[model samples]
Target: MYSNTSELAEDKLLLLYLLDKIKLPISNNKVTEIILENNFINYFTLQQYLTELANANFINYIEQEGKHRIIVSNKGLKVLSLFRNRISEVKIKAIDCYLKKQMESIKKEIAISADYTIEGNNYIVNLKAVENNSILIDLKLNVASNKQAKDLCAKWKKNSSKLYNELFKVLINN
Candidate 1:
């Protein structure tokens, strides 16, 4: 049985290890999904540790194009080198397998973009679908409410593939 404090430490280390493996900055949402899959930490605690890591200089966050990406710092690398064994080999393998399976999907999710900005008296929601670092769809729609904008963003992220296929079908059929 692991103590609560020890579990938190493990969670932090696991996160660092994951970032190291990917060797690229990933969004907090991606990290949250991976960690939640393993049931290592709850969502709120995961958010707390992400903040703690950034504050401790163990990790840094880069905000580009209105999205945040998390990268491990040199200090974090050194710490992982020192204490990575605190995480079991089993957990390590699990992370490795998870990333191998989900990395592409995660990248796709990152590539699909959605955001809303207020313009004069309306909310303009911008949605995009990208593939191979190329823009496949760039759409802007004016919506009536903040809630509608938020919902559209969520729906776009969730159903982007379906949307893309349907769009192509419509364009080709016409």
Candidate 2:
């Protein structure tokens, strides 16, 4: 879990690139070709990005015969989204003093298996890990809302997910 970041990054690039492409689970060469044709990023740098995404347990784009493919499983979307929101919020630091105790309390009540500390430019947080088999149910008290986070989680599924996911699925199914 701690080392899947690189591969997860790669997956993101592949997914993002192939999102509206000929669908995923295509040929291995197709993935490489897509990477090359994009040319927005070079080989080594791109590889590193892929590696990062993979390490984070995102998804992997593999090539088989002559097509590219994708594998989507989990939802780190909530955690990742939270990271995005709190990323620039300096006030998050104020919760530090109570964070440790809160973490302990949460661990007792929930199935958080492991945790990681992410240090941001303005804030830091200890992300309590949820079980690999469980869906993350986040319940917060209060905060000014953008609703994007709520919307993101709702879009986790194809039918219930957002237009991007539905469109992505159509392309993949073909």
Candidate 3:
């Protein structure tokens, strides 16, 4: 939606600013959701900006499990510090407000995950707990039925922390 060169630069700076503010590796989907939800930029434009930023080393992509997560680089932080004011104050405040409201949900989304796939005659369930871009636990199990796999995945998402604690306790105490 931006038609001017300055506007283009501003948009790119905005993206960098947002990524720097997040301070955590975030999924592409969540980044898209945040930018689109705020009507900051169009989807295609956002994608283009992201690619440019990555290409310029302003952002870095990490492949965790099967998902690509984005984080701001040190170079990006320096750039943001130098040109952050290119983004309007209104937009900056808006981004901060949105993050304040959504941070908890965002952290939750990044912390625990579960998925299942069929393999031969059984189902393979993968459960994980992640913190600060590190894997706290990666547990895989084989279940006999689709229903069981689904149930386990759902439970893992909801109770991974408790389950992990109990598992650690048992393993260490035994």
Candidate 4:
């Protein structure tokens, strides 16, 4: 249970602090996961703070190929630099621990993405794989139905690495 004013302040600072440490454009889902895992704040409060931070120009929300990601703005970095110490060291350590454990899963999610859109009678599915700032794969396929598009996306999420490997093998052997 948190009081209104102090709780809001702490929640905002904690969100900023987590973003600063992660140092990457992360999805709202990922941020929610970390906050919930820590159990410091409720989900509703976290969403409120995230909105407030973005509204204040402390963070920017970007949609890339249909994925929503948030990054700290220059203003955010400055604010964090000045006030990050206000957050307790214990909290910082806890965030660090959580990030360390979950980084691989985070990377896995960010590395591959799938999206679909309807064009006339068909669905166009766009599947992508990125590492660092480089695009490793950009594939688009036309499917007959929305269900097919959706199933393709689910399979892509699960079997992207294997698919990529097979693709590379065929390309190289040809």
Estimate the TM-score of every prediction: 0.67, 0.29, 0.87, 0.85
lDDT assessment of candidate 4: 0.86
* Tens-digit lDDT string for candidate 1 (75-103): 99999999998898889999999989988
Candidate 4 lDDT tens digits, 1-174 = 565665566667878888887877899999999899899778987888888899999999998656799998899888888877777778888999998998877877888998899999999999898888688899999999999999999999999999988998999999
lDDT score, candidate 3, position 51: 93
The stretch of ten residues in a row with the least summed lDDT in candidate 3 is 1-10
lDDT of 2 by residue, 70-172 (tens): 4332443433443434332332232333333344443232332221222332222122223333544322222123353344333332222234345558878
- CA lDDT of each candidate? 0.88, 0.39, 0.90, 0.86
What would you estimate as the lDDT of candidate 2?
A: 0.39
Please give the distance, in angstroms, between residue 112's alpha carbon in candidate 1 and its true position after superposition.
2.2
Sort all candidates by TM-score, best to worst.
Answer: 3, 4, 1, 2
Q: Which number leads on lDDT?
A: 3
Distance from true position, residue 167, model 3, in Å?
A: 5.2
What lDDT, from 0 to 1, does candidate 1 have?
A: 0.88
